[model samples]
Target: MVGTAADADELLRHVDERLPDVVVTDIRMPPDFTDEGLRAALQIRASHPTTGIMVLSQHVQRRYAVELIADNPSGVGYLLKQRIADVSTFCADLVRVADGGTVLDPEVVALMITRADRDHASGRRLTPRQQQVLALMAEGRSNAAIAERLSITEKAVVQHVSHIYDHLTLPPSTDDHRRVLAVLHHLSR
Candidate 1:
């Protein structure tokens, strides 16, 4: 059972027919490249209560990670594809999933934990202005809107945002929406 979510309805038909042990899938797929694969996995697990589900992704998408493990944590596994490059390790993960063992990749685990600590530690490190800026950024506000909110110039907001990005070790990019994902990842723990 490996496919994108667009075909999941049809795939679920086949899965129902075949009754596979575990459904391993990526988190991105057609019909909107969101967490479609994860949703499909959940649907499969819901319809086929006995089936175990394992999800794979290149990065630790904490949002999907959280949902995938929402139920039957012991029977669900989330692994980074990089961690499964080795055939033996991948086989071991499959065996573990088949036997209802949660197989989280070490890197993903570390990232999830570290992000939690970072979110907890952030308040103590950021200044009041920085905190305001972060809240606005999390809200998908533009630098101009953030500046207006703080009664400052857009230039100042841009500078503050850059400082925030630098402090967070995030790449400097105009599309600040990525910070929302970063915050979600941090707060997810």
Candidate 2:
């Protein structure tokens, strides 16, 4: 509600003038209409690390999602435009991003999981339940949230996370966010 811009350049200008808690932008913008918004979003991320970003796309461009979260997975999101129809969920996603949580549309998460399974042998080692847990993790869901969604206990979710880390060969980290980023990076490849 702070301000709006027509194109990527204007968007950057607005951001430079006054940074917002979260920025929601399209993956495409005016003029070239191809990734201009994403480029601007990257620039903003570089300059304003505290500000959150959410990139909306009409199509599920897995590459763009990967790119957006490549350097820093926190306070970022990539969602399909259709997600906007579910206003409550969309608002929740924005708030989550603003609070330094990564958010990926479920469809995007599914695509990444599918691609990972096809491309990486390690991905094939996971059970369907583990894959579901991993997908929720990639969507920035905490163990409690994942457990609620899966109708399981938090301990079960924790065990699944441990197994996922072992299967993916991720090193032990005190930070959960780093683990999520590592999993996402693995899937992106």
Candidate 3:
């Protein structure tokens, strides 16, 4: 449902009485649209550990996405509102959340990566190739697409991305998609 953090709390309190299994909230709402919806999502995760949550936002709030799913990713998802214009896709997002799958918006992910590039420390430390890969990845291109964009082989794109991740000291499981998010998080700051 759509509501503020306080409203969500109240709804949860009431629903806790009924034992619901899923919750969805917009990442911005009411009072101030500065990640309050994100706060509510986190609170739901904290108070109802088994409950699944899907947070929708106008933009990708990487910080909120990290906090919401970093500890326990199962049954958690984050999507941008712009990515869903039809009910079928929206319903699918909720289903994914209920099934413990992540559904991050590609645009949001790209935005986060671009934001990361702005970080003086990380940006300056990366090699030109690594930086270029990072930028292309943020554009939501797959390895092949990135390779085409950079006039390299897909395998080469993967290798360069691997180097980029290694230089950033990112974990192996940090999917290129999320690596972009992490980069964006750093850039945002």
Task: Kindly give the number of clashing pairs for every candidate.
Answer: 0, 0, 6
| Residues 112-133, model 1: lDDT tens digits | 5456556677544656687667
* Segments in model 2 whose C-alpha atoms lie over 4 Å from true places: 174-178
Residue pairs that clash (backbone atoms under 3 angstroms), model 2: none
Write the residue-wise lDDT of candidate 3 on 36-55 in tens digits.
67777787788788778877
Error of 3 at 100 (Å): 2.1
Q: Give each model's whole-structure lDDT.
A: 0.67, 0.90, 0.66
**Preferred candidate (TM-score higher): 1 or 3:** 3
Worst 10 residues of 3 by lDDT: 180-189
**TM agreement with the true structure for every prediction:** 0.58, 0.95, 0.60
Best model number under lDDT = 2
Error of 3 at 54 (Å): 1.0
Q: Could you say which candidate leads in TM-score?
A: 2
Model 2: lDDT of residue 20: 94
Candidate 3: C-alpha lDDT = 0.66
Model 2 clashing-pair count: 0
Clashing pairs in 3: 75-100, 112-184, 115-187, 116-183, 116-184, 116-187
